[model samples]
Each structure stands twice: as C-alpha cells, then as structure tokens.
Target: MSQFVCVRLIQGNGLDLTLFQFDYDLTFAAFFLNADRTLYGRYGTRSSLKEAEADMSLAGFRDALAAALKLHAGYPGNREALAGKQAHEPRFKVPEEYPALREFKLKLDYEKKEFNGCIHCHQVRDAERRLLRERNEPLSDRDMFPWPIPDLVGLALDPEKRATVKSIADGSPAARAGFRTGDDLVSLSGQALVSTADVQWVLHNANDGAKLPVRVKRDDREATLMLELPTGWRRAADVSWRPTSWDLRRMATGGLVLENLTDDERHEAGVADDKLALRVKYVGQFGAHAAGRDAGFQKGDIVIEYDGVSKRLTESGLFAHATQVRKLRDRIPITVLRKGERVKLTLPMQ
Candidate 1:
C-alpha cells in the first residue's frame, strides 16, 4: 500500500516557520528551505525521536528533504496551505525498479567490500544495456554488426575485464552519435568501469538529455565516443525473462502493441512457453470505474480474442479499435476467459 502525506507550510524566511506534521511508517521528512539553505518548514517519517533528529543532521537527508519541499511548492497548486502536495517523488529516484537502496546497502556490506566497487559497476552497466534494449535502441557497434554481449553474472565473468556491447539502433541518439556494434564500453562520461555500481552511479545521476562521454574499444583500438542520453527510451528486442505487467504498461505508445511475455507473465496468463510472449491481465476495477461503469468488463478476466483474432491484448485489433475506430465511452464486445470459462463482456472504451 502507498501512503500520501501533505505538508502545511507557513511562508517565512527559511527558519521562522512552523514544524509541520510527520509520518513514521514511510520514513520521510517534508519541509521547505530558503535560498540560503536554512530549512523553513518541517515534516519527517522517522519512527523515533532520535532517528528523526539524527536524520535531520545528515547533510544528504537534509539536502534531499529541502529540495523536495521546494519542488513541491512550485507545482500547479498553491503552497501557503500546502494541503495536497506530496513528498514521495524525490524521496526516491527510480523507486519502482533499479532502486538505489539496494545499491546503497551493497556498498556498505563489510564482507563484500573487496568486490563492492567492481561488482556494482557491472550491475550498472547491465542496467544501462537493459535500458537501451528496452527502448528499441541498438547496441553501440564499435567493431561491427550483430554484436554479441554475453551474460556477465551468469557467465561468472570478471567485471573489470569483461566487455559487453550492442549495435546502436538506427535513428536513435546513440546512432546519431556514430556508435556501432562490437564497440566495447570501456568507460562512461570519462569514468572507467571497474564495477557494476560505478555504471549505476553515473547513469543514475546523469541529466536526461545530456551528451555522455563513452570510451569504446573498437578493433583492438580504444577511442572515445560522445553519446547523447536517450531519455525515456527502451530497447525493442525480446529479452525479458519475467517481464512485469508494469513493463507492458510502459510499452504502450500511440496504440497498444503487446510485448512477448516473460516467464512469470506466461505463468500468470496461464500459458506455458519458453519463448517470450505478452498477454492481457485484467484492467482493474478502478480502471472500470474510470470507464464510467459502462466498461463491459470486470476483474479477473483474461482477454482471449479481439476482433476475431486470437492474439495478445496489445497485439489484438480490438486494442487498435479502442485507439482509432471507437469513441470514448463507446461500448464494445470482447471475449475473455474467466475461471477457465469463456465469457463475452462489453466494456466501454475508456
């Protein structure tokens, strides 16, 4: 479950303001700061008084909280009352996946210190590749076409010596920057890749559209390639082993195009297959409610066929129909599987 808390702020110079409310279970502190860096308002999520006091003393936590409060004030709403603004966004970056918490915890593991930097650096690199692939961008081809990137962790490879490269997708920023397949990624933005964490550390903090310096090893020669960051893009090829429904939701563009399911998705969709495939899960009750209660569907129903074609929901003509032919709130007939039994439901296009 998610908790949303609103801060009540009083306008004053950094310090002359009142301390607002705090939530304990979620581990957050919300408040405003002045241009000089002194905090004005206050809110926190520490469960204990000591914890709250200590968190307030940390430079990192204080900086983060101060920034959150300031950003919260500028949103398309009033700030004096600060009744509805929330504090969840900056409290965590990449929270849903590839979270910093795990990377942070791994950095402090005393038993793993010897491997910490190297191990996490590669993890970062892998995540970067996954990001590129998900955006349908090709790997940087430093050597030639059809670059082969082996699974680093699975292959028990040495992080510092191991190299993985992909052919940069055509018409992408990487491609525009002249990257090609077989190009070995030696470093990012001038920082050498020594561990998984290093890659993650850099990418996590990079500006969305900035040009990043990449040193590549091509044809046994090292060269530097300036690659532009492609924001909010993923590789197109199928590589997900257990793609979440969340991943599918992210893939939708102008129209729904279903992705091949990951292993877990196949199981959830009641299909047993080794190859990646995509399937439809229920468009939740909340979604139905948004559909004006005319959405001819209910929870727990799996879309089986759309427009007489037996295909995945994102791939079905029915989905396209929703995008093009159907008007908002228009009712349409759809066939689904409910508890292993076929059922026809008419849901309003929403």
Candidate 2:
C-alpha cells in the first residue's frame, strides 16, 4: 500500500466514464493504471447473489497488486500488451448522460452532516438499460449479460491466486481448450492476466464465435491453448441474480420479480415439470416499477402462462423474451394460479 497512491471514490455522481470504465454492476471495483493513464488491469468479480464476497479475498487483492507493480516495472516495454485493457468508447460517457438519469446533477448535494444522496454503482447499469428501453432499442445478449464470469465457459478460478484454474467442467470451452485444474492463466488473447476480472475483460470484448488464445502455466511448464466459443455463447448466462434485474423486471414482467417453483410446489400446483411455473415473489411499487401491481398481480400469484406463451422458462429467459418480442405500451395477457383456481391478468410492457 505504501508504494502506491490510493484514491477511493465513494460515489459515481460525476464519474468520468471515458477514464474509469469497468463493470458498473460490481459493488467494489479497482483499477491499476500508470500515471499516463495506461491500464494495468482490473480487480473485482462477483458470480453469486447469495454470497457475492465468496469470490474475493485479501490474498487475491495482494496477488493482483504485486502483479500490477511488476507490470509497472516493465512499464513502456509492456504498454503494447496493455492496449486491449483500455475501455472502448461508450454510448453514454457519464452516469448522468443517460436519459433515465438526466434528473441528477453532476455531483451530490452534501449539505447534510453525513452527506447527501449519490448514485450507487448498480444504478449506472440500470440507467443504461432504461435509456435503451426509452429509445425502443431491443437489448442484445451482450447488453443484457455483460462481463461473463469464467464459470460460464466451464472455468472456476481460485480466488487466492491470480487467475489459477480451480476446476473445469466437462465438454465446456475451457475443458475443450485443455485447461486443467492446476493451470495458472498467464494471459488471455494478448493481454496479461492479473485477476479473474482481467479474464472477464477479455471475454467481455469478445465477439460471438471468436477464438481466444490463452497462455497458461501447467506442471511447471508454459503452454498455449485456444478457446473456441460458439455463436450466442452469451445467451447461456443467467442474469436473474444481477442487481440490475429489478430494472429488467420493470421492463419485462411489469415489475414482478418471479421465481421458479420447486418440484414439490409444481406438483401441488398441478404444474408439470415442463410447464410454466414461475411464482411472483416480489411486486414493485411506485412509478413504472408498479406496473404489475397496477395490473392486478399479487405477490403469491403463480404464473402458469405469460404473454400467451406457456412453457418452462426461468425468469431470466422470460426477461429476454419479453423485452425483445413485445413493444413499449403493449400489454400481454397472462394466466396465474390463485387458490387452486386460474385467474387471467394483463402485464404491461414498459
């Protein structure tokens, strides 16, 4: 810590998007950069909603810091290798630039002793999606699912080490690429790897069906492997656990946060395993988020059919279908199971 100057930014009220671009969904994110603004790498990763902190540790932080210092020592000689780490030009430069966040000022009003309100990191992602909704632009798989965790490709990383493979799933891209459990990821594509977040950065920028070359250390020897992704790989990701999923609810399910019914519950509800069995877990209140409630949806309602479609679908899949198929202001008919009886309902597409 003594070797570096630390600046902790608590708010994204006036965040300079052109300079500080990373995964906005993260609760905590850090950047390692040179004085001239050359990016070394990023630190921070979350893959679970129940235990988001389980994937990070002080040891991993120390490993990433040491790696950054090593990169810093190499300096200009490694600058070309760091070029891919920089962010691309964004549609909205800053948080406030998004249409949904236009009501906000550049900074927060801090007249109060404890300081006033400010934009939370998750709000930035929410605002981006809301702006697209306002523009009537359907969200692509890339937009809905950003910064895919390594596990989606069948790679589970050891948090205590810098990009060390913990496990590989059978028949996955990582396994097909010859990634072993004990292998240490040295680099992805051409960028040097420092943390799991760095691997995510490379995957984030990758196009469908792209071939990513990886350098790895296995059994005290260096090896090169190629990871080939099929088209629509991002579609395999599940985004229902994301914090921005609330905004997705506002746009897709009329502010209803739905959950898949358990097998027992499905049997009791007379829903077959292959039938729609989403239960309305939470209904949003106020503004656009209140659409479901306004449309006569109850929290305990079991959604057996949505938008005239009735098949087994996760909440995440339903979100994708709703946003892409339905237009703004269009109401879709739905059927729910209430007290062992069927009830008809309408869900507005906001």
Candidate 3:
C-alpha cells in the first residue's frame, strides 16, 4: 500500500559530502537523491532559530516528497529540468578536510557520547567565515549574508505548501513580477522549485541587480515573470533572529545582544524616537565574546552613539558599520545612558 520508503540518518558518519548540500544552521533536513548521486530535491527551512518549525511543516514535506517521486518517475528524461538543482562543488570536500576543523577529534558514531565529537553543521559556515577573517579579507556581502531568504525578494512562501506564495509584499520584486497570493511557484531562475530551501538556494546564487525569470502556476494557467533584484537587496533580511547571529555578535559587537528601544522606553529615557538608542539586552560574560564586558560595559546600558556618530540605530546596521568601516581592535568612543546619566567610554573592537 505504501509507495515510499524512508530512511533516517541519525549520524553524519559515512555520509557522502558531495551529494548532500544544505544550510549549516538547519536542525532537520532531508535530501532526496538517486543512488547515482543526482539530487532530486531538498525539504527543510528555518527563519528563526528559536522556533524549529518556523518555516517547515508536514504538508510541505509531503508535497516535496511527492515532487521528488514524480521527478524520479521521469528519471533520466527529466534530468535536464533538474540540472540547476544539483549541488555545486564545495570549497571543502569533507568536514575533515576543513582547515579549521582538522584539529578537532571528530567521531561519527551516533550511539556514543562521543557522537558530540562529530563536526556540527553550523561549524562549516563558522569555519568558512573564520577562514576569511584570518586571511584579512574583507567580508563580502555574500560572506556576510549567506543563504538569502525569499523575503529578500519580497516573497513570503506558505510553510504548509511547497513553493506556494502565501503573501506578496507591497512593491516587492515579486509584486513587480506580477506574483499574486495563492500562486504555486514552479521555478525560479530556470531551476525547478521543490521546497522553500530550493527557492533560497536560487536566491543565494543570484547576484545583486540581476533580473531573474520566475515561472508560476496561477489557477489552471502558467505564466512567466521577471523578478528584478535591486542593489543591496540582501540587507533586507534581518540576521538577528538566526542562531548563527551569535557569531556575528561576537565579531561586530564583542558579544553584546542589542535591541532598539521602544517608543515608550525611549520617551521615558528622554531619548527621541528617531535617534539611535540601542539597549544592551545581554552581555557576554566569558571567553572571546566578553570583550564588551571587559571594556566595562554593564547591563541595561543604552548606547546612544558610537565613534562620534549616532546615525546607525539597529543592531545589524551598527554591526555592519563596525565590521566594515572600522578595523579590528580599533578603540572607539561610545556614549551610553547609565543610571540617569550620560557616560562616555572607549570601547575596543574585537
């Protein structure tokens, strides 16, 4: 009665590194592939690290599995259609090959406590960024913004339906491309859409200001549209909600979790709503991340300005400034409101 066979991989050992490709931050993921290593589709997505199922669902997984099976039935004949969905040659062929991870004693056995000895998924991304940082290379937008979300292009997809348009943001690239709510996305930039992650894959490969061809099934009809991406569009995605953002926090703010003050809070603090007022929500207490704490930063401090400038307000914006404009170990002046008084302190960039 069942047409599908499922195999669960509880460990990363003996996994073919070349065939399986996905976001390192993913908690649960599935890669449908042929025995020959041809990738069919992927099913897993997450927007918020705090919420494991934020952008995934059983309905979506079912649709993706069904789609993969359909593609399999077509077999080699449909290979051309799925060409763009294939994984690219990775920078590192295997986890053990990564220079940053070579020193760690990694074990792949899931049954043992040493299962923790295995290289975690996020480590790959962390290692990549660390490699760039160690090389003293400027972090490019792609390095800073890996795995661009569909929201960057103004498309909000339904988590319950594979590749279905849940909503279109006003004046977004999707809206301009004539995308409508309830439309089933068929392909993006010549790649067949199997899951939300597939869409993100396409977007991740897309260049800024590139015009992408989008095909969607609207009702019983199919139509093609062009989604024109503008420059700096990837910045629209907020990085604060990601679990990997902790690494970013360490790099940019020296382990300070910052949040913009609410209007009421700002008013009570006598700060204008339009001004930069980032509250120190949490300060790292130990290790390399504790540079802010070491610099005498305390909890509940409201940072009003950095380096004689107060234009950047959001944490992400401030981080961009710190990592991009300022050099590492740069001692910068910071103004913070502490216990009903303005206090100035020199903070060193880590």
Candidate 4:
C-alpha cells in the first residue's frame, strides 16, 4: 500500500508557466497521526513546511485537494459517481491492524504518493519483505537486479573507438566494476572473448556477487580486471515499471534517426560534400513519427544542421535529452536538421 499525490496548479494570470516547464518545488507533505494523535512520518518535499515556501503555495494548492476529499468523504454519491471516472484511484480497501497497510492508507489519506505510483508498489513490497525479514525469511536468486555485465560484442576490434564503447548505464553493477570506455576486454579468466554472445553466455551461468576473472586488452596487451557480479540476475526479467504518460512520451520520441542524402537532393539543396554523403543520427526519432514522416527523412538521411546550429547528433545532446528527460507530452519542443532543412515537431512516445 503505497500512496501517491499529484498536485496541479494554475498559476496567476501573468505567471509564465508552460507544460514543458519542470516543477521541482511543489512538495506534498503527509503528516500521519497515530491513535493518540501523535505525529509520524512527515513525508513530502525534501524539506520542512517552513522551508518549502516561495516555491509552493500550500493553502491554495491544498484547496482543490480538500474539496476533492470533502466530496469523496462527505458529499453524497461523490465516491460512487466518480469511481469509474477515476482510473488511477486505489481499488482496494485496507484493514487497520497492518502497519504497512496503515502507512499506505495514511499516505493516500493525504495524497502523498499516487494510488498507482512507484512508491505504492514499493511500499507494498517493502511491507511484505519487512514481514518476511522479521520472520527470518529468505528470497530466491531470481529476486534481484540482473547482473554479470558483459562487454559489447566486437569490442576487441577497434576498441579505442568511442562510438563503439559499451553503454554502462548509471547505477549498474558494471559501473562499480571500474569498467570504462577504451578498456578493451581480452577475456574471462584466461579465455578470450570471440563474440558478445560469449560474454552473455558466461553471465547466464554466473551467480550473484561472485567475483570472476576478467582480462582486458588495453594498449595492445592483456590485463586482468578483477570484479564482482551483482546479485539477482534472474529477477531482472520480472521487474517492470509503470511508466507515466510522460515516460511513454519520452520513449516514443527520443532516439536517433539517420538517412543518406541522395546526390540529386544534395545538389538541389546546395549542400556541401562535407555535410552530405553520409547518414546522420540525431536525438529523438526524427523520421519515425507522423510529423517527420514523408519529409525526406528515412533510415538514411544526411543531416546538415540542427536548429541553425551545425553539430553532430551526439554533440547536440538530443539523444541523451530524449532518453533522460521524461517530459510530459505537452512540453516537448525541439527541431532537428534533415537533409539541409530544419524540421520542428513534438514527439509522442510510442
């Protein structure tokens, strides 16, 4: 039972606010009270109520919340009438004795976490895990984050190429293993890696937190890089995230698309040889959407410029921006170059 709260505010008439604007200030505070009315967890923004001013309007913001609550708790037929309309509302009722259930109910009572928020699932899972831990329970190997990180296949060839460097996502165990770009992988233990599948196969059989022998080919020689594997590799497959519409929007739009500019098109557009004759990959899926469709962008479009700035797709931060920023569908605004022309559009995550 996790709780979720969404606070939407309509700024004063003159306030400059857009859907694209990222709000980091508005904090929802949940003050749980015990049977004796004693204060409990003050879950909300990262600060106290007094410290959260200027950036937030607690009262005006809370008014809508109070109204909604009053409707649900006091107004006649409000709950029944709105039940089908509120898709995100919690569906289950909780009993009083369960502490986790109680905490979850308390949070929801204040609208801290959403009924379907990540915190909600985590809270429920946390509660169950806590009960298990209290009873000295143990979880199986498949109940953890997947690990036994592997080097990208073909890493041995042109290992110095930054373009080919393996992606080491943040918080991954490989990050803890000191596995960095340009550190050519030679082998596991004493065996040489012939393909990416080889590394994957080795990891498939490996267990959690197990230290394995690693040999990295660096500067034309082989060197062993000792590292430990993280636990719960099997559990990785079972994990799933309930992406917000914003998350879906970001995923749909962010990714690189490059197409080759034909010789006739290049001449017609007066594009230079330096700008043409090669496929261009840019941030977000440019040619893959309705806005970008049939605009001469395809699997191979040569990009000349982006937003009047001459730069590579990787250099422009479009790819990273698309993947990193989970923006609401309303705020997406960006333009990219395709075949010497600039095309701007909002991306909808598929």
Top-lDDT structure, candidate number: 2
Better of 2 and 4 by TM-score: 2
TM-scores, each model vs. reference:
0.30, 0.94, 0.91, 0.26
Across 1-350, the per-residue lDDT of candidate 2 in tens digits comes to 88888989999888888777777777789998889988899999987788877788999999999999999999999988898998788877888888777877788656645365577788888887777777788887777888899998899999998899999999999989999999999999989988999999998889889999999998899999999888878777888888888889988987889998999999999999999989999988989889999999999999999887898888988888887777787889999999999999888898
lDDT of 3 by residue, 150-208 (tens): 87788999999989998899988889988999999888888777899999888887889
After aligning candidate 3 to the native by TM-score, how far in Å is the CA of 156 from where it should be? 1.3
Model 1 agreement with the true structure over 1-350: per-residue lDDT tens digits: 01224344222112111222222122333444345333333333121333434322344343434434544455334333233222222321321234322443322334756434322222332343335444444434210011111221111112222233434455666666666666656666654442222333344345446677777778999888776655422222122221121222222211122344556756876754532233343343333233412344444445565434454433322323343344443555656566667777565433
Question: Which rank order by TM-score, best down to worst?
Answer: 2, 3, 1, 4
Whole-model lDDT, candidate 3? 0.80
- C-alpha local distance difference test of each model: 0.38, 0.87, 0.80, 0.36
lDDT by residue (232-282, candidate 4, tens digit) is 333333111211211222233334344445667667666665552334344
Q: Report model 1's TM-score to 2 decimal places.
A: 0.30
* TM-score winner: 2
Each model's total of backbone clashes? 42, 0, 0, 17
**Ranking, lDDT, top scorer first:** 2, 3, 1, 4
Give per-model CA RMSD: 18.1, 1.9, 2.4, 23.2
